[model samples]
Structures are given as C-alpha cells and as structure tokens.
Target: MKILYLSLRFPYPPFSGDKIRTYNILKHLSYKHSISFVSFMLSPDEKNQINKLQEFCKEVEIVEFSKLKAYSNCIIRSYSGEPFQISYWYSPEMQKKVDNLMEKDGFDLVHVQFFRMAQYIKKYTDRRKILDSGDSFWLNLSRRSKLDRGIVWPLLKLEASKVRIYETEIAKWFDQVTMVSPLDMQCLLSNDSNLPISVVPMGVDLDYFQPGSKSDDLNLLFTGTIRYFPNKDAILYFYNEIFPLIKESVPNVKFYVVGNSPPKNIQNLASNGDIVVTGRVEDVRPYFDNSAVFVCPLRSGSGMQAKILEAMAMGVPVVTTSMGVTAFDAFIDKDIMVADDPKLFANKVIQLLKDRELRQNIALNARHLVEEKYGWSSIVDRFDKIYENALANRS
Candidate 1:
C-alpha cells in the first residue's frame, strides 16, 4: 500500500508523546507499505531529521512554520469561528504540497495525523482519508477551559467551543477517524452520532524501558515538555502543593524534572536543593530506571500520557491523577496509584516511597501490562489494519 501520511509535526527524535506515536507506527508500517510523509517542520532541527525519516519513508516533505508566522496566522483567524490551534498550524505551503502530492501520486489513502492537518484534507470526499486524532481535541480544550480561569478564561472557552464544532464537522468528512483511547472515541461519538471511529493506543518501547531490578536513590520524577501548558501547570501544582506535603513525611525524597525547553519558572525550581531540573538529556530511560516513583500531577489535559506508559514499562510504580490514567484501565492498587487531591497524591507517593515491597509489586504488574497490551509491535499491528482498511475502501 502507498500511504500518504500527513502530520502536524515531523515525527522524528520521538521525544514527545505525539511524535513517538506517529514515528513508531510509521517505522512499523514502512516495513510493508510504501509510506511517504508531508508534515510541518517547527524548527530547522526538524528539517534535518527529515533525512532520518527518509531511511524509513519513501519520501519526506516538510513545510517550515515559524513561531511568529503561526502567531500571526492565529491572530488573523481569531475573529473567525475556527479554533486558534487549527489556525496556528494553517499554512498555504502545506496545502499546496498536499494538493500537488494527491494530484500526482494518487495515494492509496491519506493518513491525517491531527486535527490541525484535517483542515487541509477534510474537503476531499473523493479520497479515502483516515483522521488520526491523537485525542479528542474538543475534550482537551474543554478541560483546559475549566482548569484555566481569569482573563484568559473567555479566550479558552471560545477556542474550546470552536474546537468542538470543528471536530464534529471534520468527522463528517473523513471515512474513518482514530483516537488513542476509548474515552476519546466516546466523546467524539457523543458529538457526532454517525461518525466512524477506531482506537489505536499509544505504544511504548518495551525493549528500551524494561524492568530494572535495582532501584536507585529515593528520587521521584516528572518529565515532559515543561513549557507545555498542562505540564507546566502539573509540575507547578506538584511543587507548590504536593511536594511540600510529601517532604514532611519523606524528607529524603528528591524530585527530578526531566525533558527539554522548560519554562523559566520551572527552571527556577531547580534552585531548591531537593528539586533538580535537568532540561533535556541524551536519554530518559536512565532517569526512569533510577526513580523510585514516577509522578504525574496533570490537572488539565487529555490523551494517554507517554510518560506514564514509559514509566510503567520501566517497572517503576506510578502515582498519578485520575486524568493521567484515563487511557489505561489499570487497577489502582495493582498497576498504579491514582490520586486527585494534593494530599492524597502526596500520600500515595509517600506510601510508594516507604514501602519497597508494594512498589516492587506494582512495578511488576505495570511492566507486565505494557508488555502484553501497549508494546510497540502489538499496537502498530492495529494501525496496520486501519491503514489497510482505509486503502481497501479507497475509490
């Protein structure tokens, strides 16, 4: 099958959640299908990564999108009903490239990566298109609006409303749509009753994140692009509200903030002795292996957090919010510890830190779960099916 893949970002160096998901699927699908990619490159570094993708993809084309241009586009579209996110990513170059590619190559199927790219191909009812929404974008924005209040509240609410409307409208255009979790699929179905949706879960590299028998120092870790709103909010919430409470109970506990491009506020958190912010690293698995517990205090966000899945795969017990565990229906006492309140979250972390036996038990269960259900090989097979089905249905 010749699959023309459309992505919002260049899925290379698979550091973030979306990149990892898209890149892994492509890596597997490329083995059997003639995969090509047309994606938006946010930085020059991503353009360089195009060569890396070319090793797997038959061809790779990227349209550069600068921060200033994206902001300008957002401002231009703000007055209109379109979601700011979709507008931010809108590019004439991308549209031109995609249009030319479709006309020339006659792709077996168009695999749209996110809601942002859906705008480009939504009008093409003549082609078989699969909309791979990493999550329910509408629900993500709605949750953001509820959590973020004050002067920006109205803006977030407006964006959420627009996202919901756009999501429903785009569903009608695509032959099939896919999301990371059943919860997101349900959200989509609730809004558009007749739209076809499928679940292709986020996969973890089990080989890289295998169970570590030896535990390191009593260090708790939270890792992601801290500049991202939800991650910034989550770390801040943990530092200000939860960490102090946990420290009272477990003074020896150390918190490590890993990942690249952390905000200044998060960087400043490193000034404290117990909190160490390592802004990006060559590898993250070592940190996951060394950590006693992986904490995800995400208050507002949707989708399966790759951080959680990575930690679980490394056989590290996770103490996270209910929002963090939405994708995986793992037992609270067995696979992970789910806590919503600050105190409860801290208590869970403290418990895991103090009880080695309990930690080992949960870590074993979590690793086993990922090996069985969330491994890259198994998860990518489901995606292969979706691609094959989309191609089969192509006109």
Candidate 2:
C-alpha cells in the first residue's frame, strides 16, 4: 500500500507521545507499505534529523512553522468558532504543500496524525482517509477547565466547547477515525454517538526501556513533558498534597521529575533537592533504572499515559491514580497499585518503596502484561489491518 502520512510534528527523536506513535508506526508500516511523510517542524534543527525518518519513509517533507505567526493567527481568530489549537496550527503553506502532494502521489490512503492537521485533507473525498485524533481534545480541555483555576479556566472552557463541535464534525469527513483508548472514543461519542471511531492502544519500545540494575537509593519518578498542564498539575499535586505524607513514613525517599521544558513553578520544587528536576535528559531509561517506583498522579488528561507503559516495560512498580489507568487493562494490587486520595496515594508509594518482595511481584506482573499486549510490533499490525480494511471497502 502507498500511504500519504501527515503529522503535526516530524517524528524524529520520538520523545513525546504523538511523535513516538508516529515514528513507530512509520518504522513498522514502512516494511509493508510505501509511505511518503509530510509534517510540520517547529525548529530548524529538526531538518537535520530527516535522515532518521528516511529509514522508514520513502519520501519525507518537512514544513517550517513560525511560532510567532501561529500565535498571531490564533489571536486574530480567537473570536471565531475555530478552536485555539486548530487556529494555531493553520498554515496556508502547509495546505499548499499537501495539495501538491495529493495531486502528484497516487496514494492508497491519507493518514492524519491529529485533528489539528485534518484541515489539509478534509475536503478530499476522492480517496480513503484515516484521522487518528489521538486523544479527544474536547475531553482534555474539559478536564482542564474544571481542574484549573484563575483567568485561564474561562478560556479553557471556551476552547473545550469549540473543540467538541469541531472534532465531531471533522470525524465525519474521514473514512474512519482512531484514538489511543476507549476513554477517548467515549469522549467523541458523548458529543455525537454516530461518528466512526476505533481504539488503537499505545505501545512501548520494549528493547529500549528494558529493566536494568536498580539503585539502592529510594527514588520515586514521574516522567513526561512537564510544561504540559496535566503533567504540571500532577507534579504540583504530588509535592503539595501527597509527597509530605510519604515523607512522614519514609523520610529519606526522593522524587525525580524527568522530562523536557519544565515551567518556573515546577523548577522551584527542586530548591531543596528532595525533588530532582532534570529538565531534559538525553535518555529516560537511566531514571527508570535508578528508581524503585514510578508515580503517575494525573488528575486531568485524555488517553493512555505512555510514561506508565515505559515504566511498566522497564520492570518498575507503578503507583498511579484511576485517571492514570483509564482505558488501560491491568489488575489493581496485582499488576499495579492505584489510589486517588492523597493519603492513599502516599501509602501506596511507601508500601512499594519498603516492601521489596511485593514491589518485585508487581513489577514482574506489569512487565509480563506489557510484553503480552503493549509491544509496538503487535500494535502496528492493527494499523496494517485498518488500512487493508479501508481500501477493501473502497472497492
């Protein structure tokens, strides 16, 4: 099959959730399908990494995006019905590039990475198209609107409303739609139950994140793009409400916040060194290698948390909230430890920290579960089938 793949960002480095999904899909699908990749790049440095993706894509095109201009576009269209995200990513040059490619390449199907990029192909009805909405933006914004306080909450509510309507209508333009989990699928259904949506679970690079020698130091780790609201909230919530409780029982326990681009507030938490904020590391496996437990205390977010899967794949015991495990199938107390309340969350972490035998059992169970279900090799086959089915129906 010849596929025209569109992404909001170039899938190189593969650090973030969307990039990881896109990069792996390209790698696995490229063997069976010829893919021509077109994506937006936020920095000039990204162009240098095209060679990495050339390994998977037959042809690659990267469109340079201006952050300043995108923000101006959003500000100009703020009063319009378009969602902030949709407006921010709108580029006339990108539209022109996609149009030229569609005209030149007789592709089998056009696979769009996110709804934000769906703008370029929504009008093309001559071919099969798949919109991977990733996580329902409406669900993510709605959760943020409620959990957030101050002036930004109103804007969040407004964006959520716009995204709910726009996302519902856009899915109708595609032949089929896909998301990371059932919870995200449900979010779209809540708006319009008739939209065609499928769940494709996220996966981890098992070889890259395999378990290593654990350090003797008691460490609790949370990893993600810290500047993201959900992650920012999770870290703050842990430090303010939960970390103190854990410290009472285990005074020497340390927390590590690993990821790129942490905001000022998050940076402040590392002042005394109880929390080590490694802004951006070349690799994350080292953090997972040294940690005894992985904590994902997300209060507001959509879709499955990839960080949790990576930690689980690395044979690290996980303590997370119900929100953290949504759409993830794992037995509590056996595969992982779950708690929502601050005290209970703290206790769960403390238990995992002190009891080496229990931690080992949970870690082993979690790793086995990941190997059985969440490996990318198994997950990408589902995409292959989706493409085949879509093309079959086209006939």
Candidate 3:
C-alpha cells in the first residue's frame, strides 16, 4: 500500500507516548507499505533527526512549528468555536504541503497521527483516511478543567467544551479513527454514541527495556515528561499524600522522578534527598533496574500510561491508580497493584516493598503479560487489519 502519514510532531527518539507509537507504527508498516512521512518539528534539532525516519519513510517532509503563531491563533480564534488544540496546529505551510501531496501523489491511504493534524486532510475524500488520534483530547481537557484552578481554569473549561464538539464532528471525516484505549473511546462515545472509533493500545520496546537485577533498598519510581500537567499532578499527589505513609512504614524509602522538563514545583522536590529528580537522563533503564516499585499515581489523564507499560516490560512491580492500567487486561493484584486512595495506594506500595516474594510474583506476571501482548511487533499487526477494514468500508 502507498500510505501518506502525517504527524503533529516528528516521531524520532520516541521520548513521549505519542512519538513512540507513531515511530514504531511507521517502522513496522514500512516493511510492507510505501510510506511518505510529513510532520511538524518543534525545534531545529528535531529536523536533524529526520534522517532516522528516512530509513523507513520513502519521502520525509518536516515543517518547523511556530509556538508564537500557535499561541496567537488560540487568542485570535478564542471565540471562533474552534478548539485551541486544533487551532494551535493550524499552519498554511502544512496545509499547502498536504494539499500538494494529495493532488499529485495518488496515495493509497492517508494516515493522520493526531486529530490536530486532521484539518489538513479534511477536503481529500477520494481515498481511505485513518485518524490515529491516540487518545481523547476532549477527555483530557475536561479532567483538567476540574482539577486545575486559577486563571487558566476558565480557559480550560471553555476549551474542553469546544474540544468536545470539535472532536466528535472531526472524527466522522475519517474512514477509521483509533485511540490508545477503550476508556478514551468510551469518552468520545459519550459525546456522540454513533461515532466510529476503536482502540489500539500503546506498546513498549521489550528488548531495550529488559529486566535487570534490582537493588534491595525501598525505592519508588515514576517516569514521564514532568512538564505535562497530569504527570506533575501525579508526582505531587504521591509526595504530599502517599509518600508520608510509605515513609512511616519504611523509614529509608526513596522516590525517583525521572524525565525531562520538570516544572519548578517538581524540581523543588529534590531539595530533600529522599526525592531525587533527575531531569532528562539519556537512558531510563538503569533507574528501572534499581527500582523496587514503579508507581503511577495519575488521578487524571486519558489513555494508557506508557511508563507503566515500560516498567511492566522491564519486570518492575507496579503500584498504580485505576487510570494507569485502563489500557491493559492485567489482573488487579497479580499483574499490577492498584489503589486510588492515598492510604490504600501507599499500602499497596509498601506491600510490594516489604514482601520480596510478592514483588517478584507481580513483576514476573507483569513481564509475562507484556511479553504476550505489549510488544511493538505484535501491536503494529493490528494496524494492517484496521487499514483493511477501513478500505473495505469505503463509500
């Protein structure tokens, strides 16, 4: 198949969940399909990484994204009834490039990586179009409106309303629309019960994140892009409400915040030695190797937590909230430990830490679960089926 793949961000290095999903899908599909990749790059350094993607994509095109222009669009179109999520990514250059490609390329299928990029292909209806939205932006913004306060609260609330309407309507344009999990699919369904959408889970690189010997010390780990609101909220919630209870049980317990672009509040956590905030490590495998328990205390977020998948893939016992494991079919206490209450979450962590046998058992079960289902090779095969079904349904 000749596929035209469009993404909101360049999916190289695969630092974030969206990037990881897009990169692996393109890499795997490249073996059987002819893919032409076009995406927006946030920085010049990201442009240098195009060579990596060129290995898979027959043709690669990147446009440098302007945050200044994106913000201006949000402000100018604040009352245009367009969601800021979609407006922020609107670019004349990108539209022109996509239009040119669609007019001349005669591609078999058009695969859009995110809903933000959905606008570029709305007019081209001659071929099958797949929107890999990854997750519900409407659900994410709705959660944020309730959890977040301050001047931004009103904006979040308004944006959530706008996104709810836009997301429901825009998805209908695509032949097939997919999200990262059933939870997100349900969120969109709640808005429009007849909307056509399905789930395609996020997977981990098992080989790169192989299990390693763990240290005996009580160390809890959470890994994500800390600048993201959900991650920042999760870590802070754990530190303020749950970490105290865990420390009372295990006096020498330590917490590690591993990721890049941590906010001021998250960075301040490192002031006390117990919480070690390592911003932007080249590799996170060593931290996973030493971790006794991987905790994801996410109170709000749509879709699967990729870090949890990575931890499970690396044989680390996981204690996370219900939101963290929404994408997986793992058992509550066997494959992972789950708790929403502060005390209950702390107890789950302490239980895994104190009982060596329990930790090993959960870790082994979790690893087996990932090996059987969460590997990228197995996950990408689903795309071929989705593509076939999309093409079959053409009007």
Query: lDDT (CA) for every model shown?
Result: 0.88, 0.92, 0.90
Better of 2 and 3 by lDDT: 2
Q: Residue 324 lDDT in model 1? A: 91
- Tell me how far the alpha carbon of residue 248 in candidate 3 is from the true structure, in angstroms, after superposition: 0.7
Write the number of the candidate with greater lDDT, choosing between 1 and 2: 2
- Which lDDT tens digits does candidate 3 get at residues 322-362? 88888888999999999999999999999888899999999
Off by over 4 Å in 3: none
Residue lDDT tens for model 1, 253-329: 89999999998999898888889999989899888878999999999888899999999998899998888998996
What residue runs in model 2 are displaced by over 4 Å at the alpha carbon? none
Clashes of each: 0, 0, 0
Instruction: Assess the local accuracy of residue 121 in candidate 3 as a C-alpha lDDT between 0 and 100.
Output: 95
TM-score of each: 0.96, 0.98, 0.98
What residue runs in model 1 are displaced by over 4 Å at the alpha carbon? Answer: 392-395
Superposition error at 3 for model 3 (Å): 0.5
Query: In candidate 3, what residue range of length 10 has the lowest lDDT sum?
Result: 386-395
Alpha carbon lDDT at 259, candidate 1: 94
